[model samples]
Target: MLEQGRIGTRQLSILIFMMVVGDMMLIYPSVITSYAKQDAWICALVGVPLGMALMLMFLKLSSLYPEENLIQILRSILGFWPGNVVSVFYLFFFAIGASTHTREVGDFLTSQIFQYTPVRVIILMFVITIGWGLYHGLETIGRSSELLMPILIVFILVLAFCLLPQVDPSNVKPASDVGVVPILQGILISIIYPVGELIPIMMIIPYTLKQAHRTRDVLVAAGLGNLLLAILVTISLLVLGAFLTQHNIYASFVLSQKINIGGFFERIEAIMASSWLISTYVKAMVYLYAFTVGCAELFKLKQYRILILPVSLLIFGLSNLVSPNLTFIVITVVPYWIDWDTTLSIILPGLLLLVHMFKKRWKTKSSG
Candidate 1:
């Protein structure tokens, strides 16, 4: 009940789409190709349906409590004490998500774009605007997403086609050269990061306009986003070759660097960076939204916005503490990111839904 505004189905669609593409586009292809190699796009192509299936796990759970955000739903189903405990873990997930993403933007800027600036200053600067967005509430955030989604899509489409001339077909050739097992393994990463991470959307569900078809809207939107991601991965592999795509920390950005039309139009990677920042901003707001709202609900506060600054500060502190540098994130956090996402997003929500179902059956039997 902390949210007074309701976002329309279209807004819901846009939010979910960005949520799918958000950070995954920057990082997923590299990790997948390291496993699937030349067949990474295959993993992306095949993971769509499977990813949507995983998305349904949270969507269905959200549908059951159209009025309650994920926090209240947790307490409603899992009892007072246990629910609070599990809820804290979800808060950690959201907090880490927001923090890590803030750090990612900072990392990319300091290392790739700004070379001279300190990472902490960049993070501090960005989090300030994020705090402003959080204060304006969900409707504002939703509208921002609605406005940005088209620009982001246009940027992506331009990036894709401009690089097509540079792409070598042989790079992604020998399809399934890694065989089915590794491709299947790559599908797991594909599903978990881009799709399973839809978990945090649970926080925003209550504010979305209630509709029987809302789930379908989410799935379709997310499915579109997933397909776009697959295309990008394929494009990356084709242009950068499997080795660079596999080795580059941010392959999509490097892939963007390849764009040139008769050498007249080039170095548009800044535009790519802009589009990424837009999508990342949307996704980071969701994480910050989840973090703040979860705290407000947990402590039983009247307004969630009041907690935004403190929590943003907390996230900023944790962002630095989360890892020493991008190298540490690449080595340790990237591997474990899927694990943490799996627990809160997929495994725990699935279990909660089952328990809710079992309790309903028990009540029916008892009443009879």
Candidate 2:
């Protein structure tokens, strides 16, 4: 059953914005820069429409069965047994996704800020904080996001502006120096990582108060977020150069370190780091909430909150298992994650839409 609580259209929009650009702002620029070279910004621009297209697929699926979330929609469309199997797979996908985010939080903190801190301690703290948010309820998460998102935006914009003096326009020249193929590849990567991973929003859409126009809100918010991402990528390329950005693991953090305003704003990578931590917290909350809620619905449980602790513990364990070293995590995200994200975000939803269309037509023909 869908939850009794509802989030406003604006709140939902903000949540979607945070979800898309959250952890992505810190990680994706360098990955795209590696593939697209000086034309990394162009890849981000190209990804905007592709992301919108993916968002529309999600909106369409939700609209067809307004009363049900994705798990229930799957059951309705695919039948009980098969849908149960697929739902379990989706639950597993969400768990793994959340685990990766958890690991990312730990990894970033340990590698960049707290070098001596144990990763296990960092992960434990991160999970507990997000778990507390989940335990409070979705409305709490939505309201918290609404409050924090503007501050996050302001920090990012300030950092970007501060870095302007250091940016080399010449660094971004020779656009398409590597030609269309790599730029297209970069666009796909952008789509898969930030834009396409929006598949989880399927669970959130049913909770929107303005169900009829949620699609437009999602598209607009996601587009705005992608525009911000593109601008960040442009800044990263201009300030750090494509070569340095491609080689650096934490390019955005390094870019933050470049900001020096009369020597006062020096070493404000902490601000950038804090902003990322806030955004990642929201992203992890969304994933964990989806997993908890979906599992509750699957098992016909009365309350999702009851599952929070167990799930959080499980996620904490899985996060450690995600990688023994940061290198393995990078290896997975660079080449392998796109395929996994695409299967869940694009292919699965596209197939579901096709089946629903066929079923509708069959009903129409029978009635005639």
Candidate 3:
């Protein structure tokens, strides 16, 4: 194996949790609320179990080829040349995912905090950090996630408590008044995001130390992560009201800005920013790792670490050119991004699973 480092199910769960909650806190409320209105939280709540069910299929796929990543699975199920062709599609998918994630970090830092700094500079710094993480390997990233997980949990608790005073129960009133169709629309998005995008982790899932409880731990972690997201969406609606939450680009960030206890603890929106940074950092790092691993496997390289620098450089350029600005992301990319997620994460995985089962049965009959 190119990656020799091994992590337990615990670290893997933390990584998944981080991936699930990452950028959604910043942007999801606005979009979901626009569809389901106040019942956006309802959609999120409904999404938790559905997302877990989806995750189960992914886990089952990984177990089907316990020693192989998705690229190898594709090759095994499909033939050598055909599998490589399909794998190329994943290579492009991972590359685009890495670029978009890097751009998100850069965009948030420059637009919200460092108005004077060039986005290129911020992106450069972020890319360098990711490269450093990649050079060290997956174990380093997993251990770091274990450390960050507690801090992330603290941030979540503080956020919930600090914003409680501002919550208005009436805001979420008239539940589902927008009708079942809109709520269903909101649910579809809730699944597409965070959950649907989990396909990249198939690359790293093989690195995890197997245990009887591996699947349970990871699913529980996802459930915990999505439940917190639902709570935050509810809080955003309650504090900002459905209309404002729907229109505001960063409703959770704005929610944090409202935190005040006798004026001493005011202006701690930075906490929310810090939380976002930790989560996005993990998610972006995983996508980059997947891309690098795919490149190494495609070419039959000895190790993936050597390709990190050039791949990082390519992604740096792509990040700047991915879209013109945040408006493009909000207005144009957000809609299509879900479709992209559906294709790569859902459609592809399901296809592979079907072919794998049919081939297994055929081989059994042949041997008989």
Candidate 4:
């Protein structure tokens, strides 16, 4: 069986919430606004159902084999060689995801906060911090989430409220003026990101303390997280408008900079920065933990900690090498990442689910 590290339903829910809304708060607004324009919030709202559907797919697969992770489920259903092939692909996907997040953190810090700091320095520092968390295992991570998620939520709320006075409702006017096609495209893009990124949760679901309500918790957490994201997108549009929101690399950060309370409370971008760092940190931790666990299972190793440093080094190198700079990374990933993420998170596991059902039906008929 997988190493026995269990988390309660509440912890699992918080982790899911953090993972979905983490990097999204930083990157999604600009991308979505570039396409959906004034209708970006509507596009985000529409994506919630798609996010729910994705979560259900994960729930269905995990429920079928409640005690096994995605890697082990593949091995059981697809046999050794095929399963190993698929598992390696998953490891690569997780590695790419981790690297992307590392780059995101490094880029955000370098560009927005610590302009003088080297990107490598920021990346290395983040990797080591998360790697230490990974070494302690998922339970510790869960506990950390339980503690930190509340503070992050409060910070987000404060940031949002502080910006409310500056929001110009006219900025979000001319709703859906872009027509359905662009809005639909925005929905698709949004789903691929924070929504589909929940795929990593598959590696964690089997360790939930309560199995019966696991799917319910997943759906609830997803709904709440998507709601939060939709609100953030709306706020971004209201504060920055379409053209500025689209052109600004970190639009939400820009929004946070607008927060001023009577000249006494100013320069609150630090809160935004901290929120992004903390949430993204949680997200990176989840991906790295999943990658480590998947690797240990693939090699039949008893301990995943042994592989953490080497894998982290690989991810660190890849983070630097992924693209020449943040511009290139965003330009490349925003368009093509959907194809890769969908196939792994949805298509393959979905196909396996169909096969499992068919096999069960055939066996039943034969016995009859």
Candidate 5:
């Protein structure tokens, strides 16, 4: 109803793709190696189907109310009072995620590239950039993704291909060393990260040009992303081996380091890092945009862009305060904490869908 005119379905799909593919550059390897051991790649491969299905479910739920974003739909289905409560909770989840994701990216940059810079400064720069994008709204963000995705993909693939010679294939031995249980555990965890996390995409379904195909588009984009991640994870394992891949904080980075093209090309991790950085940047923009737009819709604000600065500042502060040190981040925050964090996103919307469906059935029966 409110004409934000920020983005359309094609751009929306690009944002989703960026969000899904972006973070894999950093966290995917670590999550996979945690349980799967030498079979970490296998865990990624196994988890993809489940992740795709979960994403599809999210797409379907959102499609039921094509004209309403999740926030609007929730309010409509549940009534203003209860729906507002749900909206508040969902907003909290999304806001915290935005801050945490911001902090994670900042921490990575400070550690890997800008060793002397303060985390706050690095984070502020990110917040400012993302804030600008969010202010422009989702359509601009989506178009930006479309422009950036190809270059990002090319760099990622080139780096992976360069490292192909290093892949021993033998490194992935004793297929069941960690056993299926651990692998499944890893897959379970992996499913929630970027895959199941697409639940937030529902907030933008109202902007989709092809409303009838919204579910299919989200599923296809999500599936493509998971397939790419699976391939990247598998290649990283094959080239770097399980032990090295696990030890390396950024396994993909390490894999990039292993590349030596014709003895002429070397130390190309910088290129890989740059490409991954773009992906993360795009991902952050999408989340920030959604948060702003959702708030605008909730309060019926004249312009969502007004909140971008204040929200960015809030996110900047929270990102800094989320953890004591990067170790606290890698070992505890991401590995253990995020599991509980993602559960709300998956379960809450699902419950809402069921509730809405039941309400429709009951009303139909009563009228009959």
Candidate 6:
């Protein structure tokens, strides 16, 4: 379904990477700084191993059903009706994810850049672009990321370099301020935010052109992306310190504001916001692609273009439904996201993998 486009594992990997880093760029640093303080970077380091394990599970499942998307693979292993049920869960998850992202962009714009702009307008602009990207397919999404990643990265790195002067090694002092508990909590939250959400890759894995190398690419890209994320969080803590950055709604943006290069190159939050916007752009596109594919699969449609506007409209409405304020969204997203993302992305896929393995073992035993 969804017009049957060909995309390599590399493309999907890049999309996943973009998705994780995109939205997280805006919120994660602030969240980490709040709990872990100067040790927020520790959360990132701790999160990596767990995230990698989850990714390996995904790769194994994808390898087990090389030619099938998640829905098809579930169908083969769990029977038709059960598979459809699982797909419905995935569809719900994807839709929520889109709405959550919409809220994020809306929050950022309304809270920071444009105090007067309506969230509906911000949501509409992104939804339109996401719908356009979905209409074009995954290849278009991949190509856009490939082109935009470098520019976005350079902007972030430039901010890091500019802030190097203000970085106080003492800011990272007293490493374990509160001890392991908070760090552990932060790590758990990190897994849910970035790693758990990556489960959508299962939908794209079957579309990979380099199916033989799917495992290698996903692991490599994911690992590198996590490392980069950790480094970014670490820099935020180093530059802003725990106290200032922790309470700041947009820590990364605040950090950019501190980047005063001879006082001439200041007020770089705009640039940082631009960088984040690019990442968010790619992230939204991936979800839109998934939404289109899932809709097409569910309805037996030849293409998903007809459904794009309707889904985007739904997402726009859901974004408003989620929260009246950024504080509420931020507070709610942590636990809610972790539970939903882990259950559907990790728990469900792992169960399917286990079932498939058991069936194989039984077949072998019977044959013997």
Cα-based lDDT for every prediction? 0.87, 0.87, 0.89, 0.87, 0.76, 0.79
Model 2 lDDT, residue 166, Cα: 91
lDDT for 351 in candidate 6 is 90
lDDT of 4 at 236: 91
Candidate 5 Cα outliers beyond 4 Å, as residue runs: 211-214
TM-score of every prediction relative to native: 0.97, 0.97, 0.97, 0.96, 0.94, 0.94
TM-score of 3: 0.97
Report the number of the highest-lDDT candidate: 3
Q: Evaluate model 1: give its TM-score.
A: 0.97
Instruction: At residue 312, give the lDDT of candidate 6.
Output: 80
- Which runs in model 6 stand beyond 4 Å of their true positions? 211-213
Q: Going through the candidates in order, what is the number of backbone clashes in each? A: 0, 0, 0, 0, 2, 0
How much lDDT does candidate 2 score? 0.87
lDDT tens digits, residue span 123-167, model 1: 998898888998998999999999899988998899888887787
lDDT, candidate 3, 230-260, per-residue tens? 8889889888999999888888888888899
Clashing pairs in 3: none
- Candidate 3 residue 112 Cα shift, in angstroms, is 1.1
Q: Residue 123 lDDT in model 3?
A: 92
Provide the lDDT at 241 for model 3.
93
Backbone clashes, candidate 2? 0
